[model samples]
Target: MTIISLQHVTKDYGHGRGIFDVSFHVKKGTVYGFLGPNGAGKTTAIRHIMGFSKPQQGIVTVSGLNSWNNASTIQETLGYLPGEVALPEHLTGEQFIQMMMDLRKIKDDTHCKKLMDFFELDASGKVKRMSLGMKRKLAIVTAFMHDPDILVLDEPTSGLDPIMQQRFIDFIKDEKRRGKTILLSSHIFTEVDATCDEISIIKEGHIISSFNKQELLNMTEKVFHLTVENTKDYTQLIQMIESDITFQLISKNEQINELQISCYPSDLSKLIKRIADFPLLSFSEVPFSLEKHFMEFYDRRVGGELPWQ
Candidate 1:
């Protein structure tokens, strides 16, 4: 089921810099990553979906309802954790949870204690006395306890400790198993790589790429690092190899030359066969890394910008 859709959804400040004609869809029971760098219009797009701000152009729909027209109803079914959380200093953890449930008119507190115990949060502690991580944990528990169908989280795990982060991952997995939809906005690629089924990357307020996680992973090329024992520079090795195989000599020492090469699927056999010529002291085909893939995308975006614009 298509749980959420944004069609040409645009929001901008005075400078005409925000999400420009952005469109995407989120399916039910899947996790989607909304990826971008700072000032890439991620927060603006999120605000429009949450109905905190109205879009100047285009539409955002959740469960077939206009995000702004039926904001309250949409919110009832949405669990949101904002990038920046501000809790009143005077309110205790327990009080805050009660206030949240009151606004939704939910009388049952069944999940409150359970969530607190799960996160090891102190419900009796005042907001002012709690650490940043503790406050974040409290917000996370509060957002999830209501059993919402759609979760919209912005930078959800920024301040969390490693243990809490692992637990959060477990929580998202459990939510997905129960057929909940999640939209996660994150700069942390590793977390997104681990949690998201589909990912859309935005750069300078534009959608650069959108694809399924497994597909992207498969497209990432494996890098082969070779250090030849024989005395040969990168130029000599390039001359010896066939032209179809793409290779780059990264560095060279007195006795060995280091090369970073990529082999296309069709050329994998040819590439392995050609390596027999060089005295291979160290030859390792490194697995593709999500971090490297993310950097490559970012570099392309940065380098492709027009000079005048």
Candidate 2:
């Protein structure tokens, strides 16, 4: 079942900014990645979902409860960590944990102690004195310590070191195994690619693409480098070859041609047969990286170009 849904939800900033006609859903027991570059209205959309800000138009609901109107009630089953978390200066890590426990009315301290131990967090230090990474870890512990059914984390690993980041990823996986619903928003592509079940990409305040990992892998092309015996026009050569396969010329110098392309296993034989005509000196196919795909999306948005174009 859908745990959260945003229908025709539009948040206008008057200057023609903010999310426009945005819509998507997060189902129960799944990890949904909320992705886009900075200032792409990801934060705005998140705020709307969390009830920190009301949408200018349309519906935002969590578990069939209106997000804005039923904010407090919806938050009962939700766990959240904002993009820019600011812990109280006067509070120690222990104090902060205790405070959240108090508010949630959690009678037992078992869960809280386990979380701190799992994170190796030192709870005795004041929040103001902790390093940025340590503070982020504390925030994470606080968010998940309660083990809420639904978690909405914004830039959850922004400041952590590599080791800590790995731990956090493991934590996410563990939570998934327990059937927790998660909505993770981050500019870090690999984190999303690694932990999320499906990703929804928003650009210029609009959701442009939503696909699972396998779906994206199927859509993206793997580039190949071909070195030929002679300086021939491989454009028409590869073009005719790709007629039965899938490939495209990325760049060409005198004796070498680089093609950024992809086709299924069903078409691979046809491509190999075509390459046989060129006296193939050396050939190699390189798969697409998650970082490259992310950069492609970011570059398009930065250049103000339509994603589909």
Candidate 3:
């Protein structure tokens, strides 16, 4: 089931700013990753989903209700952590948490306590005195305290330390296990690669690529690194690769007699057979990564064309 959706959403802010023609859906019980660099309108699109800003075109919905019309209900129910957190300086962290609970009319503090303990947050300190990391922990605690079925987290681990970031990732996995639907907007490749079921890459106010995690992992071409035993073998290998239509040479180093190539998984046998003619020092498959795929869109020269495109 589609729990959250943005249909052809556009929010133009002039000067070529803001999200445009952004569309994607977050299915129930799955994590949808919204991947983009800073100033790519990630926050703009998320703001529309949260109903903090209305879309100038198209529809934004959560649980089938129009986000603009049902802002209060959606904001109150969904577990949301904004990209930039702004807390009341006058209130202590505990007081702020209590205030949120009161606003949501939540009577149970069991989950709230667990979140506090899990994040190691000391909410007794005033919000004004807390460091950026502490403030982020507090924000995370409050966001999940209610245990909402749906969550919208923007740059959730921005201010966290490495250890805390891993803890947050683990927490997200636990939430996924409990059947929570999540829309995670982030620039952190590791976190998204670790948790997302589906990923959408946005750039300069536009979505460039949207795909299933497994589908990307199953890309037809696999990259491998090779080191030849001698310069003669390396030179011959390059010549053979140049002549073969199946192999795509990514890079080569003549001095070290090393080369990288991309070949179809189905052509592995053929590749092995051909390479056997050359003296090889070592051969290893370079692990496929989301970062490599992401970089394709990130590169301005590529014009946002996906590998398959």
**TM-score list, all predictions:** 0.85, 0.83, 0.91
Across 198-306, the per-residue lDDT of candidate 1 in tens digits comes to 9988887777777788876565555788777655545566565536545444444544466667755556777788777667778887776667667766777533542
- Looking at model 1, the pairs that clash are none
From the highest TM-score down, the ranking of the candidates is: 3, 1, 2
Descending-lDDT candidate ranking = 3, 2, 1
lDDT by residue (252-306, candidate 2, tens digit) is 5643554444555556676678777766567888756777777766666433553
Per-residue lDDT of candidate 3, residues 67-164 (tens digit): 99998888666999988879989999989999999988899999999998999999998999999999999999888888899999999999999999
Model 1's alpha-carbon lDDT is 0.81
Whole-model lDDT values for every prediction: 0.81, 0.81, 0.90
Which parts of model 2 are misplaced by more than 4 Å? 224-245, 249-261, 269-285, 301-309
Write down the RMSD of all candidates, one decimal each.
Answer: 3.8, 3.7, 2.2
Clashes of each: 0, 0, 0
Number of the top TM-score candidate: 3
The superposed Cα distance between candidate 1 and the true structure at residue 284, in angstroms, equals 3.3
Clashing pairs in 3: none
